[model samples]
Target: MRADAQKNRDHLLAVAGTAIAEQGVEVSLRDIARRADVGLATLLRHFPTREALLDALLRTSFDELTARAGELETSSAPDEALVSWLRDCVVWTTEYRGVTVLMAAAIEDPDSALHASCVTLRSAGARLLARAQAAGTARGDIDGSDVFALVAMLAWLGDQPSLAPRAERLFGVVASALLTSAGGS
Candidate 1:
C-alpha cells in the first residue's frame, strides 16, 4: 500500500473509532466520511461496508486488550492481576457503547471479530485463572465466558452514569466471589 492509502486508512479508522463506538456497525458511512473530512467514495475505498469497518475496530480494540492481559498475567500475583484486569476491562467497555453492541452482534456472525476476540480473551482468561487457582485465590470453576459476560454487563452500564456507584459495588462483590478460593480448600 502506498503512503497515501495507508494515511487514508489510518484517518478513517480514527474517525470510525469514535463513530463506530457511538453509533455501532449500523452507523451511516456518509456520516463517518463527513467526520473524517473525506468523501463517501474515499471512505468506501478504504472500508467497503459498515461491517468491515466494525470488524477492523473490534479487532484492533480486543487485540490490544488481550495483549495487555498477557502482560498482566505474568507481572503480579494471580488474584491481584485478575482484579486489575477486570477493572481495566470495565473501563474499556464503557468507552464505546457502539463497539460494545457491535461485539455482541459479531459474536453471532460466523466470520466476525467476535470469534477471534473470544479466542484471544479466553487464552488470557485461562492463563490468569490458572495462576489464581494454583494459588488458591480464584475459583477453578470460573469459566472464561463468565468474565466476558461480566464485562459486557459493565459495558452496558457505562451508559447510565447515574448507576455507577451501584455498578461498582456489584462488580466488587462478583469479582471478589470469583477470585476467592472455592470450597475454602
Candidate 2:
C-alpha cells in the first residue's frame, strides 16, 4: 500500500474502533467514513466489508489476549491463570459493543475473516481451562468451548443496560462456579 493509502486505512480503522466502542459492531460504515473525514467509497476501498474492518481492528487485541493466556499459564497458578484470562477476555469483548456475538459466530465459521483469530483465542482459553482442571482447581466437566461460551455470556451481560451493573457480581459468581475451590476470586 502507498503511504497515503496506508494512512487513510489507519485513520479509518481508528475511527471505526471508536465508533464500534461507542455504538457497536453494527455501527454504520458511512458513519465511520464520515468520522474519518473520508468518503464512503474510500472506507469501502480499504475495508471491503464490515467484517474485514473489524478483523483488522480486533486481530491485534485477539493476539494479545491469546498471548496473555500463555503468559498466565506459565507465571500464575492454574486456577488464577484461568480466572484472570477469563476476566480479560470478557472485558476485551465488552470494549466493542456486540463483539461477543461476532466472536461466537466467527469461532464457528471457518470462512469468516475473524475465524482464525477467534480460534486461536478460544484454544488459548481451552489450554488454560485444561491446565486448571488438571490441577483440580477448575471443574472437569467443562471444556474450552464451555469457557468460550461463558465469556460470551458474561460479555452479553455487560452489553445490556439493565444488567450492566450486575455484570461484575455475575462474573464473580460464574468464576466461582467454574472453580472447584474458593480460589476463583
Predicted candidate 1 versus true structure: per-residue lDDT over 1-185, tens digit per residue: 99989988998998988885676556789999999999999988878877777666667767787888889887877888787777777788777664566655555666864677756765676677777888889987877767777777776776576887687777777788877744221
Q: What is the TM-score of each candidate against the true structure?
A: 0.86, 0.97
Task: Indicate which candidate wins on TM-score.
Answer: 2
lDDT of 1 at 90: 79
Where does candidate 2 clash, by residue pair?
A: none
CA error at residue 123 for candidate 2, angstroms: 0.1
Candidate 2 lDDT (Cα, 0 to 1): 0.94
Q: What is candidate 1's CA lDDT for residue 76?
A: 76
RMSD of each: 2.9, 1.0
